[model samples]
Target: MAAHMKEQTVKVKTRPDYSKQLITDIRWLLWAVTIGGLLLAAYCIHNGYVGSLPWLSAMVGLPWTAHGVVCSFYLNMAKSDHKEGGITFESAKANSFVADETNTEGPMG
Candidate 1:
């Protein structure tokens, strides 16, 4: 019968992972910052804001742009790999304490 043939059992699978989404978010933020900094620098240059203040423009724009570049590099690195899900903890108190407790003072003391 057609009804009997269509009554086969089905197994449902779990949802896909979201690590790729995390990396995508990081990359999007980095590019947004980079573009924003470049835009601000261009605005300053266009309005001749650098005529009276030389180092001010560089001080604000340079560091932000550099930070954006670094963030972009980190985003690229994060994109190269997919993270696997590790063991799940039953409760918060399951692994509350550290195995080693060696707290020492100053650099060489």
Candidate 2:
């Protein structure tokens, strides 16, 4: 009973430093873009544009990779803030103003 009471009194802290995590994620994405770009360049040089369709596709996809990485980094960092207590319904409704529900038939009908 005493041991159980002591265990219950102990507290556990689990604070995670997400700043470094975001940096590491962005760094990995940067490395991916660099490696993909180099591979595309090599393919372009070795096979020429006519035969480098696959490499061209990879090259086209590289920009999107960077964009997605940055977007995700921002999203993570933004979500780390706990002060706001999450998005409000008013803001969501204000930003999204669509038509209200309506019957498939005419309003009179």
Candidates' lDDT values, in order?
Answer: 0.52, 0.57
Q: What does the lDDT read for residue 64 in candidate 1?
A: 59
Question: In candidate 2, which residue pairs get closer than 3 Å at backbone N, Cα or C atoms, i.e. clash?
Answer: none
Candidate 2 per-residue lDDT over residues 1-109, each given as its tens digit = 6765654433444333465455556677767876778777777787766654665556657666766877686666556442344443344365574543332322112
Model 1 misplaced regions, further than 4 Å: 1-16, 51-109
TM-scores vs. true structure, each candidate: 0.35, 0.33
| Candidates in order: C-alpha RMSD to true structure | 15.0, 16.9
Which candidate has the highest TM-score of all?
A: 1
Per lDDT, the best of the predicted structures is: 2
lDDT by residue (1-109, candidate 1, tens digit) is 5865776554444333354444456567666766766677688889887565545556556655866676576555544432322222222134553332233222212
Q: Return model 1's CA RMSD, one decimal.
A: 15.0
lDDT of 1: 0.52
